[model samples]
Structures are given as C-alpha cells and as structure tokens.
Target: MFNYTMKDNCLAKKVILVTGAGSGIGRQAALTYAKLGATVILLGKTVQKLEQVYDEIIANGGAEPAIVPLDLKGATQQNYIDMSSTIAQQFGHLDGALLNASMLGELTPYTHIHQQIWDDTIKVNVTAQHLLSQALIPTMLKADNASLVFTSSGVGSKGRAYWGAYSVSKFATEGLMQVIADEYDESNLRVNAINPGATATAMRATAYPAEDQSTLATPEDIMPLYVYLMSDDSQNTTGQVIKAQ
Candidate 1:
C-alpha cells in the first residue's frame, strides 16, 4: 500500500464525480472520497449498485452522494452533455472526477475476438471516457484546481498475448491522460492515470479466476493514492502514471 494519510475535511466543499461507482475500485473511491469530505456523484450502469454505495456513504456519515445510473457501453456524447448540465445546475462546478469504469472484454487472441465485443469494449473504456471528459472540462474549469484521474491496467503499458481489446483500451486511456495533461500543463486542471495493481476486485477476479483472491490487495488498501491524487497535495502532479499496490 502507498504511504499517505488523509487529514479530516481534506476535501471539504469539493464536488467530485466518480464513474462506475457501483463496485470495485470505483465504489471504494466514491466512498473514500465522500468520507474525506467531498460530495460524491456516483455514476454506474446498475442502479442497485450505485444506490448501495450511496447508502454506505450516508451510513458512514460521509458527505451526501448523488447517483447517476448510466451504461457507459451505450452512452452517447449527448448523454454526457446532459449530465454536465445537471451537475452545473446542482453543484455549480466539479472539483474532480475518477474515470474508473471499464469493460474487460473476452481475453482471447486478437484474431479470435469478435467485432461486437471489440466495439463494446472500446465504446465503454475509450469512447465514453473521452466524451465524459469533453463534456466536463468546462465544469472542471470553474474550480481553481481540478483533478482528472483515469484508471489504467498493467497491460496498458505493454503488449500481452491474450489481453485483447481491454488492453488496447487501457493504452488509449494512458494516451488520453497524457494528451489532456499536456494540453492543460499551464493550468490548474491536472490529469493523471493510476494502475491499481493486483487488487481483489470483481474485475481482477474475472481476469484471473484461478488466482487466490485472498492474497490480493483490497480496494481500501490502495485508496491512499486516490486520496492523495485528488487532494490539493497533488495539484502539481500531472501526466505521470502512478501505480498503486
């Protein structure tokens, strides 16, 4: 786990949106951000999962969180624009966003992958993220400082034999982060990516079903970096890909 401690109210008054806040790292990030004092906006495809996270935030005495059940696989640019309008009306501006939702499409040889699976994976993991970011840039600009964090995988930086579209999408994620980071280098809006290595999440389990999940790190164990990256403590950091273990 990363060595960092969050102070009480470190994120007080911030309004952060988290995609895929329904489960795994996204869920943990939403809860953790709320606990640290940010009003969280939970976005995921499943209403039930988003509601669970919302309830947990309330039960834990964290900041109240809002839920937006959106299927990233099918969401359009207009959908993101509408969401941005809603956030603008409700919160005035957004302080940060964690782009954590992703689809691990069938891990198979490139030639064996189906077109539909490839399209769905790319649509959710790559296209949706770009659309969401494009729509939220104006909202993020309203804040003196804002952080945009993209979730990445180990396979993103290297070529693997059977990772398929999932790996390709992550590589695109890294590129997206870099491009945004470079474009905003002179501004207070920072963009970065994090690779949550070997975590015991549903996605991880799906990717490595035969592995013993008990030995992997939990979402909570790797949250310090999430908190750090979003806090004012890391406003100066951007473009770099940080690994959380």
Candidate 2:
C-alpha cells in the first residue's frame, strides 16, 4: 500500500464519472472513489441500481454522487454529446472517467457469431466508449490533469477461442486507449487500460459458474489499482495495460 492512511477520503476536489456504476466493477469503482472523497458521477442502465450506489455513498458520509441512466449498447452520439454538455455545465470539468460498462455476447464459435450480437457488443464495448470520451474530452481538458481508464480483458491482448465479439471489442478498447494516449501525450490528459483478472463479479459468475467464487478477489479487493489509476499518484503513467489480480 502507498500508506496515505487512506483517510476514508483522499480524493478531495476530484470529480470522476464511472460507467456501469450500477453493479460489479463499476459500482465498486464508484464507491471507492467516493469513499476516497471524490464527487462521483454514476452512469449505468438501471436507475434503481444506480440509486442504490448513490444511497450507499451518502450513507457512508462520502461526497454525494450523481446518477445518469444510460444504455451504452443503444446510446447515440447525440446522447453522449448532450450528456457531456450537461456534465460541463454542472461540474465545469471532469478529472477522470472509468469506461467500465460492457456487454458480453453469448459465447459461440467464431463461425457462428450472431450478427446482431456482434454489432451490439461492438456498440457497447467499443463505439459507446469512444463517443462518451469524445463528449467528455473538452471538459476533461479543462482540468489541470485528467485520466481516462478503459476496462479491458485478458482475451483482448491475446485471442481466445469462443470469446467471440467480447474479445474483439476488448482489443478495440486496448487500441482506443493507445490512440488516446498518443493523442494526448503532450496534453494534460492521460489514457490507460486495466484488466481485472478472475474477479468475483456477476460477469465472472456468468462466464464461469463452475469456479469457486471464494478463490477470486472481490471488486473491493481489486480497488487499489483503480484508486491508483484515478488519483494524482498515477499522473505519470499512460498507454499501458495494468492488471489487478
């Protein structure tokens, strides 16, 4: 540990937006950020679930949070732009954005890839991330330093049989992070990706029900990496794939 005493709140004055904030890694990231003293923006598809995170943050005496219910698979460019505009108007700048929302298409043979599923997976896992970042870059640039963290997968770096669209989408995510990192190399923004390995999340459960959940790390257990990426301590790092295992 970095040994800052954690303070129950260390992210003072930072404003972060976490996608898929309703559950799993996204929800845990939101809570971690808030508990560290950040004003977090919760973006997810389910209102009730987001409200749950919101309530938890407030109950913990952390900074209050905001909720944005959005479905990335179906989100339009205009919607993201409007969201960006709204965020700018309210917070003026964004210190960080965690692109954690994703869709896991049905596992199938590459030859049997369903067209609709492929498209939806790409939309949610790739296009939506780009659009959301596009909408927020201006706001992010306003900050003295800003971080953009993309959620990636192990299959993204190396192809795996039966992973289908999910793997392809994650590869695109890794590529996207590098592109942003290069583009903002001279700017105040930094971009990177994280691969949370074998996490005890619902997604993991769906993908590997036969595995022992007790053997894996919970979302909270992996938060140190998330916190490091979102905080000033990581201002010097970018364009790399960091693992939380």
Candidate 3:
C-alpha cells in the first residue's frame, strides 16, 4: 500500500512513453500515469500483453494509449528513429519516458556465463536504451518539461556473485542515467534512476525462487515514486538514484 497522495490531473495533457509496459512495474506505472492524466505510449515486445494493458487503461476511462511492440533485443537505431518520428507526428512531443524494459540474463557465475547471453543482455538492456534515448531526447526537448526515468537494481551498485550480465547491464544503466542527467542539468529535461527494491515481479521470481512472494512489495506499491519522478513535482530532481520499496 503506497500512501502518497497523487493529485488528480497531476500529469494532465502530458505525453509519456513507458517501456516494458506489458506487465509488472511498467504496466502498473503506465496505468497509473494514465489515471493521473497522461496519454501513455505503451512499448513492449509482446503485442498480446500490450493489448491487455491497453484495454485496462481504456476501460478505466484513462487517456487513450498508443502501443508500440518492439523487441529490444533486435531494435536498431532506425527502429528507434522511426518510433521517435511517429511520436513526434502523432503526439507532437514526449514529456517523459520510463525506461523500464530490461533483460535478466541467467544468474550464473561470470566464468559460466554464455557469450550469447551476455551479448543479448547488453543489447536489450544497454544498447537499445541508448539508441532510444538518443532518438527521444529531441522530442523531450520540445516539451516545456520532461523526465527520463531509468530502472536499476541493487546488484548494480555492488556486484553480486552469479548475477553476471544482468548486474553489469544495470551498472551501465546507472552510468547512462548520471551522464544524461548531468548533461540536462541546465535544461528543462530531467533524468533519474530508480531501484525498485524486492518487488513481486516475474523477473524477481525467476531471480529468487526460494523467496516468499507475499512478502515482497507489489508493483502497484511502487507507483508513488514512479508518478512523482515523471510528474512536475520532481522538476528540480535529477542525476540521483532513488529506492522504491
């Protein structure tokens, strides 16, 4: 149960993009953003899941959301360019993006990690994010206010055994957030990273099978921070990592 009071229309008329919006935290964030008055752009690899989220948002009387089914593992610079162009044409400008899509490659020792797994993890969690941000920054700059939120994990700060490429990828995510935040310090656009600690997500279950699911915080429980960072409330906040539990 998140106790933060979200003002109605806090995000009124804003255009926000959320990656990995098919399920988990991304899904919850997208729905919440819409409820607060943003026209959300749902981006994920699974069309079916995206559609399900789409229906939920519409059924709740939230803003009409657009869907973009994109596999980050295979997404190229051109793919991102096209997405940016479409967003600019359709929405005029993007006010925010929740860069929540990530791949948790197998949890194995560094020596046991497969080359393919490492490459794919980096491609999805790092390369695609970089390209997408590069393409979307221009769109964000067009807006009067903008925010870019990157997802991070505990392993990102201190490498853990058997975390492998996932941990390394999150480290890269942190670095990307800091660099972009610093560059945008003088601009209206703000960048920050969030570590959704011990959430009950499919990815978390896969990473910690022995843990009790009921003990973990649900995705909805983390929406307060997500909403705050994306909304104008955090306009002066940037280049920092916050924990959501």
Candidate 4:
C-alpha cells in the first residue's frame, strides 16, 4: 500500500468531486474525503446508490454531500460544462476531482471484442473523462491548490491480451493525465494518475470471479494513496502514474 499518514481534517474547507461515487473505491474515497472535512459531490448513475452514500456521509458526521446522478455512457460535453458551472456557482471553486468512473468491457480476445462494448468502454472511460476534465480545469484553477486524479489500471501502461478496450481506454487515461499535467505544470492545479492494483471490487470480481476475493485488497486498503493525491501534501507531484497496492 502507498504510505501516507493523513492528518485529521486534512481536507478542511475543500470542495471535491468524485465520479462513480456510489460504490467501490469511489464511495470509500467520498466518505474519507468528507470525514476529513471536505464537502464531496457524489456523481454516479444510480440514484438509490448515490442517496445511500449521501445518507452515510451525513450519518457519519461528515460534510453534507451533494449527489449527481449521471450515466457517463450517454453524457455530452455540454453536460460536463454545465456541471462545472454549477460547481463553480455553488462552491466558488473545486479543490479536487477524482475521475474514478470507468467501465470494464468484455474481457475477450482483441479480435473477439464486440463493437458496442468497445464503444461504451471508450466513451465512459476516455471521452467522458476528457470532457469532464476540460470543463473542471477552469473551476479547479480558482482554488489555491487543486488536484485532478485519473484512475488507471495495471494494464494501462502495459497492454494485456484479453483486456482489450478496457486496457486501451486506460492507456488513453494516462495520456490525458500527462497532457493536462504538462499544460498546468506552472499553475496551482496538479494532475496525476493512480492505478489501483487488483482490488476486491465488483469490477475485479467480474474480471476474476474464481479468484479468492478474500486475498485481494479492499477499497479502503488502497486509500492512503488516494487521499495523498487529493490532499495538498502532493502539491508538487504531477504527471505521474502511481500504483496503490
């Protein structure tokens, strides 16, 4: 696991956005950020799930979280722009954004991948992220310090045979992170990527159903790195792909 001792209320007064915030790593990150004194915006497709996370945050005495029920597969650039505008208006600025929403298209051979699955994966994992980042960058720049963290995978840097579109999308994700980091290298905004290696999530279970999930790390286990990247402690770090394992 990535080692970093987080101080209580490390993210005080910060406004953070978390996609896929309804479950898995996103949910844990949202809860953790709220607990650390940041107001979290939970963006996910399922309304009920988002409500559950929102209730949990409030019940745990964390900040009151806002929910945005959105399906990335069908979202447009305008939708992201409007979301950014809303955030700017509501919070004045965004301190951090964790682009954790992604789709695992069928893990089939390269040649056997379905067209629709490939399209959906790329749209959700790559295009939507690109658009969202573009819209969020300006809002993030308004803060004293901002972190933009993109989720990568073990197969992002090195492609695997059966990973197919999911792997390709992650590669694009890393590239996007680098591009943004370089563009804002001298600014208050920092950009980076995190590859959560083999965590025990629904996606992981779907990818490796037969594996003993008990042996894999839980979403909470990999959060030190997640919190580090979002916190001001990593203000000088950018354009890097860090592994949380």
TM-score for model 1? 0.98
Better of 1 and 3 by lDDT: 3
Question: In candidate 2, how many Å is residue 159 off?
Answer: 0.4
Candidate 2 lDDT, tens digit per residue, 86-198? 88899989999999999998789999999999999999999999999899999999888899999999999999999999999999999999999999999999999999898
Give per-residue CA lDDT, model 1, range 67-164, as digits (tens).
89899988889999999989999999999999999999998988999999999999999999999999999999989899999999999999788999
RMSD of each: 0.8, 1.5, 1.1, 0.7
Structural similarity to truth (TM-score) of each candidate: 0.98, 0.97, 0.98, 0.99
Better of 2 and 3 by TM-score: 3
For residues 14-104, could you state the per-residue lDDT of candidate 3 as single tens digits?
A: 9999999999999999999999999999999999999999999999999899999999998889999999999999989999999999999
Model 4, which residues run further than 4 Å from truth?
none
Q: Candidates ranked by lDDT, best first?
A: 4, 3, 1, 2
**What C-alpha lDDT does candidate 4 achieve relative to the native structure?**
0.95
The digit string of per-residue lDDT tens for model 4 on 71-145 reads 999999999999999999999999999999999989998889999999999999999999999999999999999
Worst 10-residue lDDT window, candidate 1: 1-10
TM-score of model number 3? 0.98
Model 3 regions more than 4 Å off:
1-3
lDDT of each: 0.93, 0.91, 0.94, 0.95
